[model samples]
Target: KLKDAHCAILVVKMKRTLIMFSFILLQLLLGNSLSPKHSSPKPNAEVTVMGFVYCDVCSNNSFTRHSYFMSGVEVRIVCRFKAASSRTNEMITFSANRTTNEFGLYKVAITSLDCADVDSLASSCQAKILSTTRNEKLVDRL
Candidate 1:
């Protein structure tokens, strides 16, 4: 009879422990749901510009032995607004400067946040390719 009583007590304790653990887990989940660390940006969010330089057949014609010409190229990837807005401008202001690799490929990345700093110089905004120096000859984009 004593052994049976002890087993019952153990079972009760186990149930209480499980209930407490579940309560703590529920609290944690609820807390996180209430306050997210990084809320998603609104639709038609601010522009994030990324510039990539690549060498392609500059000529309109198809690839040929002599047609494999290389030239420094620059491109802009605009983040356009999804919906039209009266207050919003047609295009966001963004610019980046970068030099191409030996194979003629370079890239730059800028965010709308960067534009807030009026004192920020143009050189500061440019994405520097630290690995490749002016002397270094790169075969492809890194």
Candidate 2:
């Protein structure tokens, strides 16, 4: 009788373990299926570079400091494509003629040709913002 009881207990424990493992696997599978995979931009990404050009040191003269502020600060986006399959640098320029708005806002829509080149593209691009009125020091990132 004792041996039978031990056998039954072992069987129950085994069943419980199997059930727990199945539940965990189901949860993992569900989570994976629901989540979206990491893919490249679908050639329809509306890339915009918008920021305020403010003098960090000068807060006293708002009007005079930004009086000569103009738009179109020469923004260029270089899309680096350095994948395992690619040998050389496959950089694509999204916009060059585009410039910032009146309130210091710039928007550049990437072309389909540029987006379709690489499977995975860089999200944001490094830019050198240069203005004639401001000194070279002000020609920082955007």
Candidate 3:
């Protein structure tokens, strides 16, 4: 009778351990599935440049309360990227013309296999207002 009792106690302990292990495994799977996933940009992915065109009404070289966004403005975007590796003497250039939307926002998409990472974009990209179709119909070059 003592041996039977011992076996019963061992069986109960085993069942408890199995239940705890199953709970822990279920928690791990659920946590992994519910967690937000962070994705890094893949190589050769398209890069977009976006900005707003605003008229500096005060001419202080900055936006003020009097300033307003200009729609239907023609903008030219140019980007030049050097080769990722210094061993290769390769340069990629991207140029596109885009018109500002009603919100005075312009977006240019550039896709190239030779594109450098985002860190190098600041030094390699340029955008300028090619023309403005406001009431004055002024054309400016930069």
Candidate 4:
């Protein structure tokens, strides 16, 4: 009789523990993540992004630092993300190029984000260099 009572008490304790654990899990999953720590901001929700492009003219020269603003380079907005299970990251790219004014200044308005990619748009927006008009060659010395 004592053994049966002990078993019943153990069962009751187990049931309460399971119920408490479930409630905690529900709160964590359903609660709004207002904390900045959990929030990955969808930044600069603007359609337009602007920047400059430069050529490392001295890419091969270790001792010299020489770079020039590239006038006709293609600058782009690129986004890369990968799921833990996926073999490779899916890259989404958007570009609208313009010939830089004499100053090597270029302004680009992202035309790619619309009905299809509105959600992931701001989260993955990044500026990148696409290509340059001048053929890149190894310069041995200045």
Q: After superposition, which runs of candidate 3 have C-alpha atoms over 4 Å from their true positions?
A: 1-43, 114-118, 135-142
Kindly indicate the candidate among 1 and 4 with the higher TM-score: 4
Instruction: Give the poorly placed runs of model 1, Cα more than 4 Å off.
Output: 41-142
Ranking by TM-score: 3, 2, 4, 1
lDDT of each: 0.45, 0.54, 0.76, 0.55
Across residues 1-142, which tens digit of lDDT does each residue of candidate 1 receive?
Answer: 9999999999999999999999999999998988858977654323333333332334433443433323353332222222244454443345445555444554444434422332332323333333332332212322
- lDDT, candidate 2, residue 35? 91
Better of 2 and 3 by lDDT: 3
Please tell me which predicted candidate would have the highest TM-score against the true structure: 3
Q: Give the TM-score comparing model 2 with the true structure, all chains together.
A: 0.38
CA displacement after TM-score superposition, residue 53 of candidate 4 (Å): 1.4
Clashes of 2: 0
Assess the local accuracy of residue 112 in candidate 4 as a C-alpha lDDT between 0 and 100.
35
Residue-level lDDT tens digits of model 2 in 119-141 = 45545455556453555233323
lDDT of 4 by residue, 1-142 (tens): 9999999999999999999999998888767464346556546433555555555566753434576665765555554333223454554555454545565666655543432344555565565555666786322110
What is the TM-score of each predicted model, taking all chains together?
Answer: 0.34, 0.38, 0.59, 0.35
Candidates 3 and 4 compared by lDDT, better number: 3
How well is each residue in 1-142 modelled by candidate 3, as lDDT tens digits? 9999999999999999999999999999999999999788666766788878888766666767887778899898888776577677577777899998897888977776454545566577777887876654232222
Clashing pairs in 3: none
Index of the highest-lDDT prediction: 3
Residue 132 in candidate 4, Cα distance off native in Å: 3.9
Q: For residue 124, what is the lDDT in candidate 4?
A: 58
